[model samples]
Target chain A: MKYISEYRDRQVIDRLAGQIASFRDTKAVFMEVCGTHTMSIHRFDIPSLLPAGLRLLSGPGCPVCVTPVGYMDHAIALARQGKHIIATFGDLVRVPGSTSTLEKARAEGADVRTVYSITEALELARTHPGRKVIFLAIGFETTAPATAAGVLQAQKEQLRNFCILSAHKVMPPALEMLASEGVKIDGYLCPGHVSVITGEEIYRFIPRKYGVGCVIAGFEPADILLAILLLLKQVTDGKPRVENAYKRAVRKEGNPKAREMMESVFRPVDTEWRGLGMVKKSGLVLREEFASMDAAGQIRVMVEPPVEPQGCICGQILKGIAAPSDCPLFGKMCHPGNPVGACMVSSEGTCQNAFKFQSDG
Target chain B: MDELIMMAHGSGGKKMHELIRNLFVKYFRNPFLESGGDAAVVPPEPGHIAFTTDSYVVDPLFFPGGDIGKLAVSGTINDLAVSGAAPRYISAGFIIEEGFPVKDLESVVRSMAGTAKQAGVQIVAGDTKVVNKGKCDRLFVNTSGVGIISEKHTHIATADHVKAGDQVIISGYVGDHGMAVLSQREGFPVKTGLKSDCTPLNDLIGKVLERFDHVHFMRDPTRGGVATALCELAEGRQFGVLIKEPAIPVREEVMGLSEMFGFDPLYVPCEGRVLIVADQSVSQGILHTLHGHPDGENAAVIGEITTGNWGKVVLETIAGGRRIIHMLTGEQLPRIC
Candidate 1:
């Protein structure tokens, strides 16, 4: 890979590691805000190699882990009804709802699926016109364009049978909530793919007001190390700034067209985060302009106040105060094959990342 | 004979024969080919035989560059090529639905014939069975090919042949076929500018094989990208594969779509591209020759085989990061979410 390989020089890693060892600032908690980075760190066993005292705490990075209890309940409710086939990404199916997860509902004969793209849900609706194919939409900005595309596509095809129960959330508001939570964060590692579309501008709020250094980085070890080094410089110098370590892909302004598409389709709305309380304007709602594509808009959703299973601290886990292992059900009750929380369901989730890579969780 | 097998035609009998004779044989007539024995006895040859089978269920059966028919034949032949073989003959099997249009079938068959001709292979035999509608996804075609492995060092093992410094070479562009299929399927069809690179690489592989005696192993990164292919090649050898993401060839649209879909193009399937493992010391001349060939024009040394935790593949991403590639346990694209 052109811009990719030269930076992965092992000699560079050793040199950088040596440089970091020379400084040896152990008290700072370098929080990686992106779930991808959290998983990447564990998958590569990065923490073990880091100099002692440089703690890497996972922020509320996993979008799936942050998905509130109500969303899963609503999806499972729709799935169990058997009238509509609930199509969603792999993340949602295993997340525990109030009664059961979508996987359980599916085994009990609900037409639940783990789709790769929202467009695939449109295809299912197109193929099986008789069935109401509702998509269980979730994710941050990077994944929103596809759902937005699905809405436009459904409208174009006049797919009355297809609709979306949206739970897509935005990142900036969530980051603000994290900063508000008083989580000890000396720096922030931004998501690469998200930054590519969102640019590095929206994240300026975090460093300016909060005094935490933020680096928009690619999800690579070298990229991560560079972001950490930048954060370290900020911490040591007592200066707060936003830097772009992944400039090859991410631009300063991000992809305006994609952002426009997303904004045009979805509006900022108050949404419930599983562990994090309902952060205002964190969720994406179908714009009144595209209300017809929204399942929430089309039908009278008599959803009860969302409830969670007893003792599942998915919300606390999302805030980085507790790890997945800290939860009583981490492995015993919340295995990937059987999940008790939404966090354990998605691969990009904190719990799933912990389960798959950080088994200590 | 008896006005014969309708779709009841293929319910296991002579009626099926009549249907085949009238609809299929009438179009695909060949003098040396017939399909009625326990197994067709092919001519014996001195060189080892390279055999491969692929079951294609690609939707939008007819896409920009190819259809299910072309996909079946071309895919199997490509597999043979990656095995250091000169593809010779292919046998196609179609699990078609009953209500399928004769015109559609004609177009598909004609396409298969054209693709077979382009690959320099003959469809020597075939079997057809039609199930009821709503059962099959349009038409599912499975093809198996037999080719002559003429390379003297044909006893290739991805693990056995690879060393710490062995170079990784890709035949050409990656993710073309996967992205092309995705574009049309999602209804955001952009005039279908892309074509499936569903061409056979038998001759191209033969060319590389002739000049390079140190060519360790070759594989078409079909369903699992170069990452999975390398993982398989590195099996039992306890060696790791290091890939430079920038060196991996991916088209702009593919790169954009990958970003949109949150997928690694390296894990997405491709039917045309091949990954070659060769000692890095001996790779310059092979890469030059590959660069000359039209099919391998975009070829580049994406990575190198290394002696490390064997059977592991490390992708040194463009962002100056590394990710150890895991063989995806399941298919790339699922129904929907």
Candidate 2:
């Protein structure tokens, strides 16, 4: 815990809190574009230490929360076919599809399993040679590289039974969409893990085009408080720039090997986000060379048109226009145990994080 | 073929009798079980007795610190000990899958015998059954225990005497047992030197109970970790509990692994730890006594009960902020990053 404990030091955190409070009179709103950041902000109770004028909004950073309903419907349709084994992240098991969820599909005799990584799914394909294994590949750039590696591994092994249902997305195009939509925002608290792979330079366009301050932050209390302090300084000085506050893990050049792996297997395609609709070149699909490893190309199933749940404002919440509390079904009809919306499903989703960790009576 | 267990071993024939005599009775030898009756008959006790049961189905059967056998016995003993009783007798039942190695089964039985002997508890009765392959996870153990509660220690069970100004104490590091098992699970990539804190806590609890009459409540933080245990304690109550985040004791490996997996150490399980609620006057004395024992060497006062915020458990975060501790509603899933 050497590196982690220092970041969580009480003395350092209290001093940063004091410094953040010194700019209490300044008015600004900063958006954090990562699900892990949203979870950390609430887990550390960072908002309690911040000034009232300085507000933090959760953006569409949670990949599970941003995935469109049609995507889940297709996955469920494949699960119902009873010929393939569906491997997915744990949170996706509970995410509600149009008609049923993967959890329900599993209980009713679907071969669905939760894996910690894509490597585990690949191992399943290696062992269960008789059954086809489909990995539900969904996440930001931080996880896309691993899926890409899984694809390359399958190709090398000639594992025809393994394929990926890719729903991977990039961060920069989504940020551009947010700016183009003219959402109110002063600055952005860039994601730490995603920035580690894509590098700090990818966010330079935000400052040049929109004149908004950007600070890449780590997922600790002191790191976030320091990021807020830096953003406040930028707003006061009227100088907007993409600064790397989490230099310990994030580099300006980013991780080249991971980017290379991702580029080899996937190509950009316009995809649908739950709230943001379709953004050009935002999603990743398997390239033509690796098309045989794509689940969509190998399997064909009929799925009904997707339907959104009624009285669910997850769309507005993911867009950072409203809070989870603004929804009427937040705590009453929806909860972590029986989530009614996608935002309430994943532990990192804004609504789920707020419901589980936020200190409100 | 005889090296592995077969269905005939549970058929109540020659194989069944041979397994019972060679495996179970050889290790868990006791007078009550030697009688070979349908029920264990013991002398009548004068004091109130506590009865508790637990089931152990942990995956990977054996890990760095302990196995399912150790977990089953320790879990039952801790349950009775936390209720302010001296655990005296236990009954073990096993449902093992067919084709399991006989040597592995003997190793688990030996572990159980060793742990029970160290705790001075008798395994008075037993039963075994073998199912088809894949019916059970390799094995499952269920243990029921009986313990006698002295008159003076009965107050710990009711917890009615607990009031404001009382202190909360945790015996040792949290999340060791959980992370130890998690790091060694089948599909995980990381391997570490972490060991599970899976040991009997009866000696530690008995010492503290004998020395302090003001110990109002005691509970083992097993599943759902410290946060869930504390939340259950404060639920539907007239008082609130406030705990300092930095004061809680956690190991470096546990903290590191939990951070790596995106799991919170506060919500993981600790097998060999106890949470005590005692009056302010005897809080220091209890800590002093707990620290003297090897199991309680890292004991510390973590929090105190307050007169406000009815039924709420609040934590003073490391950053000088506060958050409510809610009961764990679902499994703690590893984040997708």
Candidate 3:
């Protein structure tokens, strides 16, 4: 609790809140590009504490929310075959596919288990040698290294029953795509955990090309508030540069060993996002050496074209263009219990966060 | 007997009789059970009858601070207690696996008897059944209790009685019971020295009801913790709830585990805590009285009911911000009770 309790000190938070209130003059729109940040901002109700001139928007950072419906459909299809055990993180279990969700498939007796890390999936394969284990690998850079390490370990151990359906995505291309689309984002609070792996250097393009201020932030209340204050300072000084507010964890040069492991196992590929369409080279695929451990290449399953839920504005919400309340089916049709969209399915999804924290608004 | 429970232990023969007379009856020796009759025939008391039943299928059969037996009895007692009833008699039924250890069963039964004695309740009648090894877990307990709701406390502790100005008071720290079970199941590497806050709260609740008539609603925040309980209270009601984040009591260790796992302590389960809703004027008095009891020593006034944002519960965060608190949708696995 040493690192956690100190950051949540009410006295420090109040002082920072006062500083943010006084520092802001002109209206500004800032976007937090991590699902964890979105969750923390809503969980702590940071938006209501900020001055009215500042607006915080949630970007496409939730890996579970942005995972395309086709990925879930394929995973569910494989699970329905009863020939494979589908393992995933807890965040992706309830997200709906084209027709059914992994949770529904699980109720129908599919062998779906929620593993904390991909290494657990490998352990499942090791324990149950007869059953085929397919990990639904979905996450950003912070999680990709672990998945890569699992694959490398599987290869070293020669685990034939273990494979992964890689839906791993990178952050830089998506940020570039957001800027190219002129989405009206004035500043950005970059993801802290992702920066720990990719490093602060990956976000240099945001300021050099798009002229938008970027500040890498941690998940704590003080960290986020400090990131906001830094972005405000950059904007007020007419300086567009990337700053690291989460210096305790993140560095300009990220963990080289993790990057090297991930690079050896995965290669960049074009993949589709749930809300945002395909961005070139934004996804990770198994390298040729580890292609045998790829579930997508091994499994021969035909999935139907995904049909978006009627009137769900999750796509717009993920891009920070529309709020969760903007959708007509928000509370009535799309709720966390029976989510109609990916945004309402994942706990870190923008709509889910809004539904949980900003429903009264 | 056999050292372990066999199929013959549930065959209604000499083995079954010995298992009951020696193992169960030896521990549960109340006069009502000593009657040896098929049913517990009790005379009617001058009050409304409150009947509640619960089945405990908790994994591990035992946990840090309590076991399945303790949970079964305390769970039933808490249900009746929160309904303004004075729990008196409970009937226990057991569904046990065929090869379960006799020693473990005795420990569980002894725990049930001990909890009943502490809560001043009687275990009157009971039944036992055995299934094949794979058909059931080691043991499962089902308990149904009958309590008397005196005229003074009748209908007072209902959610419908919650008005706009009612204050929400939690008995003590939240999330201890949940974190204790999770740490055991998930094998969290960090040692927090946390134990399950599972205990009988009927005495504490009865004391509060006896002294305060302004109490409107009472609920045990068992499975879904305080957030779910408050949301349930707001549902279908014409009022909203606003809770202060800093006001809610959570232990530092519990908070640490919660943060490490990216979980909100507000939604963590608590087996031993009771959430009370009372008029604003009597809130401090109720808090003072609760502090006198061991179970309610850490009690705090955490929130209040409001007319705005009807059917919703919002949290005023420690950062001087506000957000809505919603009910949990998915299964928070490794369930404690």
Q: What share of the reference contacts is kept in model 1?
A: 0.03
Residue range A235-293, candidate 2, lDDT tens digits: 99999999999999998999999999999999999999888889899999999999888
Compare the candidates by TM-score and give the number of the best one. Answer: 2
Question: Which segments of model 1 are wrong by more than 4 Å?
Answer: A1-27, A32-56, A85-182, A189-234, A239-272, A277-317, A321-347, A350-361, B1-19, B26-29, B34-39, B157-159, B189-192, B334-337
Give the range of the ten consecutive residues with the poorest summed lDDT in model 2 chain B.
Answer: B328-337
Model 3: per-residue Cα lDDT over A220-253, one tens digit each: 8999999999998888889999999999999799
RMSD in angstroms, candidate 1?
Answer: 6.2
Candidate 1 lDDT (Cα, whole model)?
A: 0.76
Q: Score the docking of each candidate (DockQ).
A: 0.07, 0.60, 0.60
The better-scoring model by DockQ among 1 and 3 is 3
Where's the lowest-lDDT run of ten residues in candidate 3 chain A? A352-361
lDDT of 1 by residue, B1-337 (tens): 4322237656767867765676556655554355555455667887888888888888878777778887888788887877777888888788877777766777788888878777778777778887877778667888998988764757663235557888888988888887787777744434447777777777788788888788888888877777678777766666778787767888876766765565668877777777888877779988898889888889899988776657777766443446566665444654110
Clashing pairs in 2: none
- The TM-score between candidate 3 and the true structure equals 0.95
Give the number of the best model, judged by DockQ: 2
Ranking by lDDT: 2, 3, 1
i-RMS for every candidate: 6.9, 1.9, 2.4
On a 0 to 1 DockQ scale, where is model 3? 0.60
